[model samples]
Target: MRIAIDAMGGDFGPRVVIPACIDALTRHPHLSLTLVGQQDEISAYIPSAERQQFADRLTVLHADKVIGNTDKPSHALRQRKQTSMHEALCLVADGHAQACVSAGNTGALMALSRFVLKMLPGIDRPAIITAIPSRKGDSYMLDLGANVDCSAEHLLQFAIMGSVMTQAVAGIAEPKVGLLNVGEEEIKGNEQVKLASRLIKEHGGINYAGFIEGDDICAGKVDVVVCDGFVGNIALKSSEGVARLIGRQLRDGFSGSVFRRLLGWLVKPVLQDIASYIDPARRNGASLLGLQGIVVKSHGGADRQCFGYAIDQAVAEVSMDVPNCINRQLEKSIAIKYRLKRSP
Candidate 1:
């Protein structure tokens, strides 16, 4: 499999992205990587020994321009044709690479991806979906800052796409799909959530699990959670904040006294495992679902390891043929629904 990397997209530029690409190449030997960015900057960071080791599997595509973090998506789309992010995505659109990964501006990335790759036949818009650690394992949530305002139909579309993605990428058969709402009762949510629930339940393809509250997300009540981008993004950021707070408090309490410090030492292994599990970097990849081709988005501030995780995500999706799976599932569901509607 071959994947394109936006080497100059993230806050740290090639410093983080280049190492991440190297790490991904080392881990996935069958993979080929094409780093898209300024050739000189990318080459300066990659040591000659490392380059020689993976010479056959690695290639650099020079792109002199870069899309800035704060650049407006509209302006970037029109003016940033020569940017690393745009070119990297172009590689996927042209089928030169199987997938593309970028830690660039979310809005700009989405705009460019949709314009270049186009949405699937039945999909009106592409939703952003990512995995988050949960008690049952990991839960996939969609519309995370992609489409802030969504309709009932959009939410239903998100449910279908999220369910298919979880099943394809995570190896979950019949993944339980949940609508993110304020309450578990069918009558509790607003018009959009309530209607989305009805639509999902009516659709036989998904394993609809009714409504799930915010707390249920961490408890792992469902494998897939669907919501508008506004709510999903807020929930994601808030959960991240709480995780940081708890981690900090635990560290401070553990160092408060000799006895506590000793206790901390005793539980050091357990704590380390928990820390790694909740680490955002480990879950750095978010898919731009509903697109015709596969595109993975990494956190703009992600480190080398985090960015590498994003690359891994792109590889997994490419290997699993996630976009094609979603297309097939969606077409099947629509066919079933059409038949049902025509029946007495």
Candidate 2:
């Protein structure tokens, strides 16, 4: 499979993206990588020896402009053919590559993806979906920062898209779906939440688990959690912050006095394991669900390891044929709802 990388996007740009692409190429012999960025900068970072080793599978496509971190989404759409981000996305849309991976500005990537790849037939808008690690297992969440204000119909659409992807990617037969809200009771939450609940429950394909709270997300009570981007993005950032704080506090506590230092040394392996489990870089990629083609968005501040996870996600999605599976299952669910509504 071939994957395109927006090498000039993100905090480190080519410095981080290039290493991740090289590592992926080395790890997967059958895979080919196309780095889309300025030729000189991209080549400068890669050593000549290693470049020759993988010359057969590695190719760099020069792009003069790059989408800035603060570039407006509207402005990005206007310069479709110029930016590296747009060209990387076009690689997927044009069938030149199996997927496109970028650690670029989230807003610009979303706007460009929807325009270039178009939305699946029945999807109203594209959503950002990622796997959130939890105690019981990993749960899939959607609208991380895509549609801020979603209507009942949009929430229902998100559920269908999330459910289909969860099933295809996670291999869950009927993934349990939950609506994130302040309380789990039917009486709680805004009118939109209540109405969305009813719509999800009525859908024949979705395994609606009713409403779930913020705390329930890490508890892994449901397989898929659905929310608007406004709430989902805040929740995601807050969780990342809390994890860093707790990890720092623990490390500080362990390094205090002689006895504490001795104990810390003995438990270093355990702490390392815990750190690995909670590491954001270990799980950084998010799929722009509902697009016609595969596009994985890496975190804007991602390093080589973090960005590599994004490439892994793209590879997995491509192998699973995620877009085709989602399109079929989504239309099936919509048809089921229509039939039930008309049955009298």
On TM-score, the leading prediction is 1
TM-score of each: 0.98, 0.97
The global Cα lDDT (0 to 1) of model 2 is 0.91
Writing each residue's lDDT as its tens digit, candidate 2 over 1-344 gives 99999999999999999899888988888889999989999999888887999998899999999999999999899976768999988889899998999998899999999999999988889999998878977899998989999999899989988998899889999999999999988999999989999988887778999999999999989999999999999988888888898789889999879999999999999999988887767789999999999999999999888899999999889989888988998879778978887998
Give the Å error, residue 237, model 1: 0.6
**Cα lDDT listed for each candidate:** 0.92, 0.91
**Tens-digit lDDT string for candidate 1 (137-235):** 999998899999999889988999999999888999989998999999878989888888888888889999999999998899999999999999999
